[model samples]
Target chain A: MKNIVKIEQLELASAVVELGKKVGAGLAAIGLTGAGAGVGIVFAAFILAVGMNPNLRGELFKLAMLGFALSEAVGLLALMMSFLILYS
Target chain B: MKSLFEQFEIDLYCIIITRFFDVSITTITVYLGLLMVIVIGMYKVSLYKATLIGNNNWQHIGEMIYEFVVDLILEQVGKPGILFFPFIMSLFLFVLTLNVMGLIPLSFTVTGQLLVTFTLAITIMIGITIWGFRIHGIKFLNIFVPSGIEPWLLPLLVFIEIMSYVLRPISLAVRLFANMLAGHLLIHIIGVAAIYLMQFYFIGILPWICVIAFMFLELGIAFLQAYVFVLLTLIYIANIINLH
Candidate 1:
C-alpha cells in the first residue's frame, strides 16, 4: 500500500519545473496582450492622422509599418523568452 | 501521439561522404530546387530588355520586387544605402522563397532551424559591424554611447545600449525562427487534430476549417516575416551608417 502511495505521489522537482514553465510562459504572454492593444492603438492613431491629412498616407504608412515591426519585435521577444523558459 | 517536433526531423541520405559531413537530403533538395527556380527566372528575365512597352507577368513581378527593395533601402538608408541593393534584394528573395516553400506539403523549411537563421543573422551582424568600423573608425564604439546624455545616467544607458546592440543577431534570428516554428507547429497540430476528429461526424469539420484558415494565415505570415526580417536588417544597417 505504501509503495503504491509513493508511486502515486508526484515528483516535486519535476512538478516544480513544469509549473515554472507554465508560469513563465504565462507571464511572458502577458506582453502579447499589451502588444495587441498597442498595435490597435497604433493603427487607430494612424487612421486619425491619415484622416486629418490624406496626403500624409504614404509617409504615415512607412512610419506605421516601422512602428508595427518594432512593436511586433517586442511581442516576439516575449515569445522567445517564454520558449526559452519552456525549452531550455 | 507523435511528437510535435517530429516535423523538424532531418533524415540523412544513404550516400554519406564522411562521418563529419552527413548530408540532409531534404534540405539539400529544397535549396537546389530554390536555386534552380531563381536561376531559370533570372535567365528568363535577362532575355528581355527594360522596355517601357507591354511587359509580361514575370518581368512585371521582377521589376516590382526590384523597385520595392530599392525603395525600402532608400527609405531607411537614403542615397548611400543604394550600395547594398544587390545583397539586400538577394537575401530577401532567398529567405522569402524558403519561407513560402515551407508552406508546400512534405517540404522542409530551412529558416525554421536556428542553425540556418542564426548563421545568416550572425554573418550580417559581423558584416555590418565591420562596415560600421570601416566607416567610422574608432568612433564606431560611440554607437554604445548616446549623444546629449546626463553624466550620471551615461554609464547605465551605455550599458543598456551595449547589451541591446549585442542582442541584435539573437533577436533577429529568434524572431524568424520562432515565428516560422510556431506557425508550422500550429498548422501541424491543428491538422493532426482534424485528422483525429474525423472519427466524429459533424465535429471533424471544425478543426479542418481551422486548419485551412491557419494555413492561409501562415502563408501571409511567411511573406510578412520575410519582409520584417529584411526591413529590420535595413534599419540596423541604417542605424550603424547614420550613427543616430
Candidate 2:
C-alpha cells in the first residue's frame, strides 16, 4: 500500500513539473521584448499627444493603442516559437 | 509589471516538420490526403448512393463550399482564372481550417505563424510568376513596363514597377500574418480583461456580454481574413495573366 502511494505521488509530481515546463516554454515563445517596446512607444506617443492637447488625449490614446497592438505582433512570433519548443 | 499590458506567453501546438524529401513530396502528401478524404467520402457516399446528392447533409455542405470557392474565384479573377480554381480553393480551405482551429480553446492557430503565411505567400507568388512567364513568354517582362509612357520615362517606370513586383510576396505574407496575429491577440486581450474584470464586480453581466460580442467579432474576422487573403491572391494572378 505504501509503495503504491509513493508511486502515485511520484506521478503527480512529474505531471506538475511537465505542466510547469509547458507553461514556461509557452511564455518564453511569446517574446515579451517586442511587446515591451511597443508599450513603451505607445506610452510615449500618448504622452506626446496629451501634451499637444489634453482634450484629444482620449481619442489619440485609443488610436495609439491600436498601433501598439500592431507593433506587438512581432513579439507574437516569439510566442509561437516558444510554444513550438515547449509543446513539440 | 502589474500593468494591463503585462506580457504573457502563448504556446502553439503545431510545429513545422522537415523531411529530406523535395517539395513535390509535400505536394504529394497534400494530394494524397485530399484523395484519401475523397475516397473515404466516396465509400460513405456509396452507402447512401440511393439518396440524391442534395438530400445528404455532408454532400450538400461539401458542394456548397465548392460552389462558394468557385464563385469567389470567378468573381475576383474572371473566367480565364478558373484554371487556378483548385490551387486557390485548396489554399482558402486549408488556411480557413487552420485559422478557425486556433479559436478552439487550447488548439494552435497555424496561420498565426509567420512561416506558414510566408510559405503560402511565396508559393502563390512563385506559382503565379511561373504561370505568367509560361503563358506570356518573354513578354512577361512587359508587366514592368507601363503602356503609353513616354520613351524617356520608361526606364524609371519599369524600376518602380519592378520594386512593386518584388514587394508583392512581402505584402501578401505580411497582410495575412498581421491580420491573423492581431486578431488572435486582440481576442486574447479581451478574454484576459474579462477575467480580471470578473474578479472585481457583480458586473458579471457586462463582462459576459462583451465576451460574447468579441467572440462573434473574432468569428467574422476569421472568415474575413481568409476571404481577403484568397481574394488578393486571385487579383494578383489576374494582374499577372492580364485577364479582363
Candidate 3:
C-alpha cells in the first residue's frame, strides 16, 4: 500500500504539467472576452457618432472601420497567443 | 476521432530536379496552382462576353468590384491613391479567393498559413516605406513626428510612433492569419462533431443543422476579412502619401 501511494505521488507530478497547460490555455482565452468588450465599445461609439450626424456616415465609416480593425487586431493577437500556447 | 489538424498537414509529393536545386511540390503547391487557375479563369470567363447595358451578371459583378475598389481608394487616399488601383484590386481578389477556397470541403486554406500572409504584408510594408522615401526623401521620416508637440514629449512620442509604425505589418498579418485559422478550426470542429453525432440517427440532424449555419458565418467572415484587409491597406497607403 505504501508503494502504491508513492507511485500515485509520482503520477501527480507529471499530471501537474498537463494541468498547467490546460489552465494556461483557459486563461489565455479570457482575452477573447476583452476583445468582445473592445469591439462593443468601438461599435457603440461608431453608432453614436453616426446617429448624431448621419451625413458624416461616409467619413465616419472609414474611421470606424479603421478603429474596428485595430481593436480586432489586438484581440486576435491575444487569441494567437492562446492558440500558440494550446497548440504548440 | 481523427485529429482535425490532420487537414493542415503538408505532405510532400515529389521533388523536381532543377539545374541548381531541387523543388519539392506539396499540397499547398497543388492548391495554389488550382487557385491561380480559378482566379484567372474567373476573370476571363466573366468578362469574355460582357455586354455594356445588357443583363450580363458576371460583368456587372466585375464592374461593381472595380467601382467599389476605386471608391475605396478615392475615399481614403483621394486622387493620388487611384494610382494603386491594380495592386489594391489584386490584393482584395486574392485574399477573398483564398478565404472562399478554404470554405470548399477538404481544401487547404493557404491564408491560414502565417508564412503566406506575413510575406504579403511585409512586402507591402517595405514597398510603401520605399515609396514614401522616394516621394518625400529623408523628410518622409517626419512621419514619425507629430505636429506641434512639446520638445520633451516629442522624443517619447517619436519612439511610440515608430514602434506602432513598425508593428503595422505584423498586425496586418496576424489579424488575417488568426482570423482564418480560428474560423476554419471552428468550422472543422463543428463538422467533425456533426459527423460523429449523426451516427446516432435522428439526434445527429441538429449538429448537421448547426454545421450549415456556421458555414454561412464562415462565408461572411471570409468576405469581411478580405474587405477589412483592403480597407486597412488603403489607409496605410494614404497615411504614407499624405504623412498625416
Candidate 4:
C-alpha cells in the first residue's frame, strides 16, 4: 500500500511539472502573437495617417518606420526572455 | 479563487529541445521548414496555368515582396545591385516571413531567436567581405582607409574603420534580435496587464486600450524591421564595392 502511494505521488509530481511547462509555453505564445498583431495594426494606421497629411508624410513615414523597428525589438526581447525563463 | 492568468507565468526562453549539438539540427529544421513552404508556394504558382492569367493573392504578395527587395537593391546598392539581388531578396523575404509567422497564434517566431538572426548577420557579413576581396583583391584593404584624410590621421582612421567593419555583424544581429525580442515582451506584458487590471472594471479599459494601440504599432514594425535590415546590408555592401 505504501509503495502504491509513493508511486501515485511521483506521478502527481510529474504531472505538475508537465502542466507548469505547458502554462509557461502558453504565456509566451500569447505574448508574442499579440505583439505581432499589434505591430500590423500600427503600420496600417501609419499608412492612413500619411495619406491624410501630405506635409508630414515623409517625416512621419520615417518615424513610423523607426517606431515599427523599435516595437519589433521589444517582441524579440520578450521571446529571448521567455526562453531564458523556461530553461533557467 | 485565483485567476487563471495567475496560474501561468510565461517562459520566453523555453527550449524546445535541450541537446548541445542537437540544437543545430532543430534550428536547421526550422529554417528548412520555412524554405519548404516558400518553395512549395512558388512551385504551385508556377505549375498552375491559372497563375499566369490572373492575380492570385499568394502570387501578388510574393511579387510585391520581390519588387520591394529589387527597389531596395537599386536605391541603396545602385546598378551593380544585380550581383547582390539574390542575397538581399532572400534575407528580406526570410526575415519578413519569419516576422509574419510569429504573428500567427502558437507559431514560433524564428526571427525572435538570437541564433537565427546572428547566423543571418554573419552570413551577410561574410558574403560582403568575400565580395569585397573578390572585386577589389588586395585593394580591398583600402576599404579601411578614407579619402581626403590627413596623412598623419590615416592610421587612426583605418583603425577606426576596421573596428567598425568588424562590429558590423554584431550590430546587425543585435538590431534584429533585440527588436524581435522586445516587441514580443511588450505584447506579453500588455496581455498580462490587461488580465490583471480586469478585476477593476473601469481600470480594465485602459489596459485594453494600451493593448490595442501597441498591437497596431507592432504590425508596422514587422515590415519596417525587415526593410531596415536589408537597407543596412545594401549600404554596407555598397561601401565595400564602392559602386557609387
Q: In DockQ terms, which candidate is top?
A: 3
Q: Which digits, one per residue and each the tens of the lDDT, describe model 3 over residues B1-244?
A: 7775777778899888899977879887887888789878977877685744555887888888899999989888999998899999999999999999988998889899999999999999999999999999999998999999989889999999999999999888988998888888899888888877877886947897899999998897788889999988888999999887
The DockQ of predicted model 1 stands at 0.45
For model 3, what is the alpha-carbon lDDT of residue A29?
A: 82
For model 3, report DockQ.
Answer: 0.51
Best by lDDT: 3
List, residue by residue over A35-85, the lDDT tens digit for candidate 4.
687679779889898788878887677666766665655565556556655
How does chain A of every candidate compare to the true chain A by TM-score?
A: 0.80, 0.56, 0.80, 0.63
> Taking the tens digit of each residue's C-alpha lDDT, what string does model 1 give over A1-88?
6555453356876788899888988898787887787778889999999999999999898788667766766776677687778777
Best by TM-score: 3
Error of 4 at B61 (Å): 2.0
Task: Enumerate the candidates' DockQ scores in order.
Answer: 0.45, 0.06, 0.51, 0.33
Sorted by TM-score (best first), the order is: 3, 1, 4, 2
Higher-lDDT candidate of 1 and 2? 1
Off by over 4 Å in 2: A1-88, B1-53
- 1 versus 3: better lDDT goes to: 3
lDDT of each: 0.83, 0.70, 0.86, 0.73
Model 2 chain A: weakest 10-residue lDDT segment is A65-74
Ranking by DockQ: 3, 1, 4, 2
Model 3 chain A, poorest ten-residue lDDT window? A1-10
Candidate 3 global TM-score: 0.89
